[model samples]
Target: MVNKLVFLILSTVILVGNQSFAQKKITLKEAFKDKFLIGVAVNRSQINQSNQEETKLITSQFNALTAENDMKWMYIHPKEDTFNFEQADKLVELAKANDMFVVGHTLVWHSQLAPWVFKTDKGDTINNAELTSRLKKHISTIVEKYKGKIDAWDVVNEALAEDGSYRKSPFYTIGGESFIENAFRFAHTADPEAELYYNDYNLINAEKRDGAIRIINNLKSKNIKIDGVGIQAHWSLEEPTIEEIETAIKMYSETGVKVMFTELDISVLPSPWNSPTADVSVSFENNPTMNPYPNGLPDSVQTQLAKRYAAIFELFNKHADKIGRVTFWGLHDGLSWKNNFPIRGRTDYTLLFDRAMEPKKAFNAVIDTVND
Candidate 1:
């Protein structure tokens, strides 16, 4: 009788162990398979598969990929006549091999642009006609090369000011608002099947959100193929309440285009400025207080991070239909731009994954939102 009992107990333990293993196997991609794609912005190292562990983690957890900087105007077309496809090509091939959706980061932007794009050999500003021609050539060349492979393009990035006016960028100065329209038109002409998006940060603010809508409506009214709006959700622990985010999502979707949470990361550090901003040019001197938690994040702070993520994901789940994709800015905390952005040499725990590539409390929290 005792022997029989032992055999039954052993069988029960084996079955329970298998069930536990299965539960742990559920990944971010698997959890949101029906709702939307789970994507991560990857750098050159990740795309080249140089780090085996990171590559494995990326393939296992995510179903979509965005080249963090490779496909940008400055890197892809550095010189006026020279086009470099070495890294960008590798990224596309990597995405294809993994069967992941590919997002072309950006075609036109005020920042990170090649110098020659707006200047002559004698350091003179180019005319509107020359600028427009250069813009068309740049957009057409990149879009046509990976026409079918790239699923979407962030055609114009950060073109709107905070007060619902056009950012006086060189593009705007040269071509006015027609630059945006021409960009979308050029992209569509190159690849009619690809989706085009206007990406900007701080879009949750009422005025900026309205500005984005104006751009969307303007494109639609002109019959331009603007398909989505990418909100660069570079949020922090205590700013931009859940209601604000949800409202922005609803309002953007009401414009008849999908809303994407692109470049998503929640910083767990103190902001130097009073208001939230993601302007890359802004910087401050780092103090010891600013760089707190350098050794590691405390359990209490980690819990806050986890709960904050949980609430954000719950909101994302509630509006899944309107959200096309949710892409984390980087794969791991160490790779996050938050560590140095706005303040240099400050260690910030912003991403879902920790520095060691292990899923942190925030990652589990995000996954649990769907699992529950």
Candidate 2:
């Protein structure tokens, strides 16, 4: 009788916790409504409304949504002459329907590009002149299509490497250091009112932070428009001390540009490399040491996750004036890119919601910080 009674109580508690998050009157978007936008990156399933619960979470909790892949160059502009708007249109339509802010991610990227992006229509090597023309056309077309809709554009992304060096992407190789300047110029020409950001990860590293600073300042000096800096906070629990994040935010804000915590997620698994890069391409084979906690997140790890998110949100609240947006890379643990990233088939609990779509302690902790 005691065992059955205890079982009933435990079951009731689980049911209550799961329902409470969605049942609550307020949302993350509503909590931070006046301060800055709360956002999440959306996959196609979410945009298509196939993932109904995720869609509900997005509509309820977030005021902004950036596409996880649709807006990227290859996906939207696959062929040399074929600029596909089907997938991207769905995202914009959903955002508009939900009254959410839209951030058009990635006008240019080193990865995930069709060969036509780097080659001419006639299969010729894209010279500097050809590349510049292509850039102008591509930027103009995309920015114009979603001009009044997408609130911001990641005008350029991950253009710098670690150790403060410019990444030798095809753009840089062909257009020289001047490519970034010209890209921003093209984007501004297409949509003068929409905000433009230079987005990248690992800004907490001093060298990378300073490099981003130099890039933004140089744009401003040249009279090119740069509105914000995106720190893709694809972080771990322990590394990047709060001091470093705060310092980076303060530094970026000093550039007279809004600071954004873009692609924010805290990975609990052991990293394959010690000092990780922002590169999403880096991956390794799964092993027990790296894939610990595959079955489920331990309670201790869950607490640490809560504490970590709370601290970061506290810092964000402290500097709310300088921040423009804070976007999680994904909506929930089951959908997080961290799971397949750096090792496919590795289970990862790197988001505020668990695989069951229930809010973790981290979600409640963030809400408490805002309320406090």
Candidate 3:
């Protein structure tokens, strides 16, 4: 009798353990379902993976993948003389292990770039020739290192402000407008097989839309080797209507460049910035509290956001032939840039998962749309 009781207890424990494991397990096959590409952004800390849990979550959901680190110039080479390839190397290994289509986030960008890149050893502005050589060397070394591992590269990023003009990023001031074209060309030369891209934000607005079209036209006219355009859909709950986003997509597609929703997230909140400090004095230029976060996204708001995503995704599915990949800015809401930018100090939920890592209503809603 005693032996039998012990056996029963052990059986129960095993059963409960199995159930717990099953709850966390999601295969890449399950995540992809019928979609061509569904991706999530990951951080370096997440890659210290002990199990296949995170990998499974990513691969099951996405076919086309991107590293938010390796592609960025600052991440690849933080210091002038030191080029740290550790983080990016791990991402590549993970992608290869999961059979995922990896994309390099960016080769050149105004944001997240090293400040020293604009200056020389003598602390003066580097000449155009030196700048061009550094650009080529950086692109060639990194892209060539990844070679066949990465599928696409966002060679340039966020070069345009909200208006229909250049943001006048450090790269632009140092290398001129031709810098954009040169980045793409240099990246291509590094890995002739990789598809090169230009990424930007606020594309849904009319002014930015025109700017993107003009840039694409400029590249085409110059016979530049541009492949795709990455629309950084850093959207708010209100403002950019579904029609507006679709319109932007159509407009860019008209340029014969494939579009990818690169950095996507909808800020579902009590107010735009979700901060009490944003009462009124927040200036648009420097104040992070300019936009107030909503009180809290109620169930209805969540559903509406899901519907918007579904509609946009439906557009993507319809035009999958012209689309390359759809990537969420961050995998989990806790790590999103929205947590700190635009609003200085605000605790808000604006991603597919909440802080607890559980899929919110929008997650199921998106899945349902994909299934439908």
Candidate 4:
């Protein structure tokens, strides 16, 4: 019966390999229970509860939900007066049903904005006074409607340039730097209990970090209630070193404001400009060389990704007291913006979960870091 014994042995080995790192009783939310909440961005599909498999993972591993696009200006308020709360309401209800914290993505941003936001009925650019009034009314309507339901909000997003200079966004050009604090003021008026945050990418860069801190300090000086800062931790494998991130964490912590590692994802693809900034407008022509791992991530690159996540989690654990939450940009790599961002049709494996909703090695590495 030598063949029988070999079959038994082979079956045992295969089973063990598959079960070793598969989903278990252990979950990311449970792992980081002692620290901050684990969060993920939910698309409209997730909001409708259509994807049971994805929802199962999200419910088990995450305790915070950020609407991927439902709460944006373009979707929430397509017209100046028309406010649609259909999907937005569903998102909040989903979070409440799951007993998860809810965060409103953004109140003001330059991108994905309606043309009417910057123009009048006559197709003319609105003046500063009219624009400020519009901003106040918009923030008030959304924030007040979900006052107690939404716990936090990205009060203002992407306001600082990478070089620490104020970007010439429409808000800045019309209302000037005063728009930043004014937005915070309007949100506070809507819901004083709601925690407000300013979120942006490239936060690890020293210049941008300083600019953010200056804004936060100025808000506090004006007696405006600014609660936290969201550092969109969209990083790559090699750059920003662990040291740079650690330094930023400490500096933001020093501001006496909670630091959130928002939009946390590590890209495994080649950089288009070798920059750390996250600009959806930036794009390039398709190049297979940029997407070398079209078939899939090699085992070696997977290990590197795992190692990178583990290291970052280790740092987060060290500063768990200062941090508020760590959120993945999306649930799975297949749905990650990186897959279609910068260049369309690129197979980028840049998230903790694979295309099949299976937890990749990086997931385990992060769990291990918090467990330790």
**Candidate 1 lDDT, 94-158, residue by residue in tens:** 88898999999999999988888899889999989998999999999999999998999999999
Sorting all predicted structures by lDDT, with the top scorer first, yields 1, 4, 2, 3
Question: Given candidate 4, what's the lDDT at residue 158?
Answer: 96
Ranking by TM-score: 1, 4, 2, 3
TM-score for each model: 0.94, 0.92, 0.82, 0.93
lDDT of 3 by residue, 62-128 (tens): 6666776655777788777778788788888888887777888878876677777878778998888
Q: Which digits, one per residue and each the tens of the lDDT, describe model 4 over residues 71-155? A: 9999998999999999989998988999999999999999888779989889999999999999999999999999999999999
The lowest-lDDT stretch of 10 consecutive residues in candidate 1 is 16-25
Each candidate's lDDT (Cα)? Answer: 0.92, 0.89, 0.72, 0.90
Cα RMSD, each candidate: 2.7, 6.0, 7.9, 5.0
lDDT-best of 1 and 2: 1
Per-residue lDDT value at 201 in model 4: 89
Distance from true location, Cα of 330 in model 4, Å: 0.4
Instruction: Name the candidate, 2 or 4, with the larger lDDT value.
Output: 4
